[model samples]
Target: MSRVFEKRYALSRRALLRSVGGLGALTAMPLLSHEAFAQPVFRVYPFQLGVAAGDPQPDGFVIWTRLAPEPLDLGYGMPSEPVEVKWEVAADAGFRTVARSGTAVARPELGHSVHVEVAGLEPARPYWYRFTAGKERSLYGRARTTPLAGTDLQRVRFGVAGCQHYEQGYFTAYRKLAAEPDLDFVFCYGDYIYEYRGERLANGGTGPIETIRQHNEGEIYSLDDYRRRYAQYKMDADLQAAHAAAAWFTTWDDHEIDNNWVGDIDQDGTPAEVFRLRRQAAAQAYFENMPLRARSFPIGPSVQLYRRASYGRLLDLNLLDTRQYRTDQPCGDEWAATCAGVAAREAQVLGAAQEKWLLDSLSGSRARWKVLAQQIMMMDLDRAPGKAVGYNLDSWAGYAQPRDRLLRQIRDRRIENAIVITGDEHQNFAGELHLTGATPGPRPIASEFVVTSISSGGNGQDQRPDMIEIQRANPQLKFNNAQRGYMICDVTPERWESEFKVLDKVSDREGALSTRTKLAVAADDARVVSA
Candidate 1:
């Protein structure tokens, strides 16, 4: 639900291996082509990776699938030619009332993927869809369109999450989310797949720096590698179930391409030109796998992201691309006793263009709540607890002026009820947004809720040692939980309620979920409080 799309627009990492192996046989069969569009094809199911819907507009949404009879293989066992993939949307799960139907070509360049942008239908309603190629048919997908723009609504329910390192743990959080019958949509804020070849790792400190499984190949630099990595991640039943359950608005973070990568700086010290190629491959694979429109598909190294989606007059969600345009982390990308260049005026995190766009949009917003769905923490989190401020340069704290500029826009325009829902740090955080990039200062102007990972960091405790330090260091923050899970938001005209949904364990598939706590932010007060 980021980029603009018309009806025709078109449209990981781990232990993952054992889990993926259970998906089915990796055996593949012979080729099928559009010339043989009428011929029966595929010995194995072509929709092995599953179906998903995204970029939902008022009138329609984009439904997607890939023809991968042998999912793990580079070619995915599809012929090197155009394949005609047909899709249909209906009013019932049984598809009794067919609403619209069309055909799309799965090109070889795009790894034989299908993206169907469906339109000319009712808004704010449920529709079921399926894809067909030859005699093989895909599982049905369910999608819901947004309400008409400017139309007032009673409520909105959604989930926010990301950072699922397959090898690190199971996707049980996604399973729980999918089962939630009340959710309207889900915002996936990146780290969709880890780029590192599955290398088994072990705990090095307090962080989830280890993995039970490793990447099958070394550092992925080719389009095929990216596609395969994505395929591997997609094999998870829980993840696929969530995709089928509700519409998703997704954006990328560091691991989707490379860890903590900024612009051409891949953090791995790859040259800008070399990293550009990798980025290009990663971007292309991302587009092919995602339920995005042709409007957002990549052209070489760049893809159009950072767009707005409105849920009637109740909410305006702005999905942002922070890693694509940001400058390298100031004073090196690490937590230090002090980072010197953090306050430089010219340093950009959102870049001048996106900054202007965000500021202008926030200033002009007429909705009750403006939520920024993005990667990385926007709140200034102190790495070292003390009176002398120490900051993590990898976040908004590194690009000081730009953050201040946006905060100033809010403070100046009185952009009431603007909140940021973020993902990255594998821990949940609820805080009041203050202009001071460093927290525990000034009056609250906006609010931020950083959702924990789906799995990435492995199973954690009810509390971590740093929680007390962080809370004491930054009073603006109201909550912190180092667990494996996500957050649920139930928004209404008067109050926005949040529940920190946590999982007792994510080391395997046998975990159960419970709410750690619930928070509420009154519409006008813009302060996080106990619900």
Candidate 2:
């Protein structure tokens, strides 16, 4: 049997402390009045957004929750005193015998959110945790720590989703995913929250119906607006439930700030300085709200979004940052003066530093599968012959020189079990990456799996004829489908399976999900096959 499925954690109480005595008790005395302490303690906001864990490592994982006095943020404008939150780990769902317990203060600066990274936990073992503040008690969340590095793990299962536009319909898809008992964790590729308003998209779309208060204060461009937007998205009961269900590894694409905007630039053509400030604000809000490590925090307009995560010897995920540093979009013929002068080789999608990191990581990885969790398609999908014209110039195809260089590295290094998982195209595609094309200089190298959006562009109902024509023109394309839903990727030592899980309908508010397609990659060949 595979160690991935058979792993277990032994429960043993390492430490325990209550507010009655100890350092936390002594610290809590001055902050709270006698009357406040006298009242019966209640875990009122036990787990406002449900218990969530993320950024897991072999030694530990981050456990999180928000302490809300009220169901919404109405009760307190801003919590003056730091709230002492308690957390525990157990071997079973019910904390019959607590293993570890600690106190963490929920600072008002972060809207009373508490994130506890419990270290020294046994690897590849399932554990349950919860948080408590006063009379309120949060729901118990289950999380599994990563297996020891290079362990011979056999199988791992996870769900990959993106572009969950709130106004389109209910989060029925997430509700369904939450109920699924098998997923180890959730990988939100991007567009977790659409920055646009309901009226902005031609319909009365409210963008995923959630309990969190909506951002009634116009389009979000500043730090405050971004914070409100995140709070609104987090309020969705289904989304909260899903978070409670498993840990999440996430990254952001353009919609998190502005659609299709490149480095330090604004989509509406705002001044460079003004746009850079906006980017900084948005980045700050993102860091504050997300369950990210301190390392991902924004430094000026840039956040280090690209990094690697491992799952024993089974898989290694290299999350890519595609939008942060890149040249502006290529202009049309009418604006040739602006586009023609731009140097294609000097232009890049991953930038120099990130690209170098990726190359180095790929060369040294020992996992059975090396997966690239990226934002856009890596395989070239040209819109016109000898001309760049598909999707947008922001994708890999737009920066041809860099794309070729990357492919050449893969070929030269002979990096085995390399796979690319992408989002942002609003369509599902399977392409056999030939590093060297017939007209090109070098030889063939990689493979790519581009997942369709959860709900974007109104379910991609209007298919582009040019896209279909282009597919026919390109022989490397194995599969293509424009749909609304996500992908469920199952990895094993022998093979990797990517199931295109699609919703029955997106136009209707209440619709079921189904597997529209399935593609598999054999361990030996690393080639995709229709299941």
Candidate 3:
């Protein structure tokens, strides 16, 4: 049996909504001083959005929640003045022994969200937490700190999931993951919420796909719009349960702001200056909703998301921000066989500074496994069926020079057991990473595992039409599954195993999960073999 906490945190999204809807608006209550610490009365339950904790350190982590009785509204029905929120962490799920308690201000400017940075706790242990705003108490949440910097562990496990478009299907993946016991943490690699206002083509294709549900309004632009969008996603019981289950380490991809957006460049050709403002709004909402530390707080349109998380001396997890600093996609961001722009030397994915930082971190780290938790595929995938060799301009294949440079450094530095877990591209993939144009390339330097979407596509097939041909074309590709689910990774000092847990269908709430495939890599080898 997994050595997990006996108590579990569970809640239903609809029940909270139904119960809170009966309460009237906050306007029905009296005004309060901005600086007053006194509890103010809320017309509805202020903790309807649920509670979350993330960014775990050996000694501490950050806990988060928002005062949103009315989640869909632009203002969230929050009062104009700041509200004081109280937080408490306990050794037991029942709160019989409180470990730490503090107060935080949920300012109206930040959509009345509370972020409490907690410390002075034991390392590598489960802690239960909750928040209080006025008379309402939040759902109980569980968080765990990492092992000490140099401590060694026998094993580690985590889930990789993202790209959940609310309109596509249900978030049964999250619900299942929440039930998983003894997970160290969850890594949401990107596309936490799709920015599409309504049903859109499955990648600018011929026809618009039908939606199981729909967004509340048109395309989001303002801060309130982004906040409401996040609220809609957070309101899901499964997503909330997943947040409450354990601490999450999150990083974003294109859809969080706009589809295929690179820095200030919008896919629809929106002016860079105008898009910057939208990005600012998106960034702020992202900061407010996520269980992130102060290091990732948004400043205008910029947020520092690239950081390293260590789990003892066994793994060094590097969370990357690929969308925020990337150059505009090459060849108009389309699939092409032989475009000159695809190999442009100036094109960058991680940019110079971030590239240097990643390289330095990987080289300097002493951990047995160096895991790159990021968005977008780093493998050079040729999508064309036959020998045409088309590549996605939005992926690393478009920026060949930079990708080759990074791979060369990894090979030269001999960074053993390097693995990359990626989101985006609503399909599952397991492949070996090799230099693009090497003459009969040597052994792979690293490995990559791409997890499929939580619910981006409606119901996905077990196999795609061109999957076999594409695999034949690229021998480095080991496996591909077009399904809706996530990856559960089990790591040890000697090897790493990735279990591709997929859903039969995500169109409804009754989809069942099963292991589609399992792949493993040895400590010093990059070859991906069936487990």
Which candidate leads the pack in TM-score? 3
- Cα RMSD (angstroms) for every candidate in the order listed: 8.2, 8.6, 8.2
Q: Whose lDDT is higher: candidate 1's or candidate 3's?
A: 3
**What's model 1's TM-score?**
0.91
On lDDT, who's better, 1 or 2?
A: 1
Q: Cα miss at 250, model 1 (Å)?
A: 0.8
Model 3, 333-405: lDDT tens digits are 8775648877888888898889999999999999999999999888888888566768877888888988899
TM-score order of candidates, top first: 3, 1, 2
Which candidate, 2 or 3, has the higher TM-score?
3
Q: Which ten residues in a row have the lowest lDDT in candidate 1?
A: 4-13
Per-candidate TM vs. native? Answer: 0.91, 0.84, 0.91
**lDDT of candidate 1?**
0.81
Q: What's the ranking of the predictions by lDDT, best on top?
A: 3, 1, 2
lDDT of 2 at 395: 70
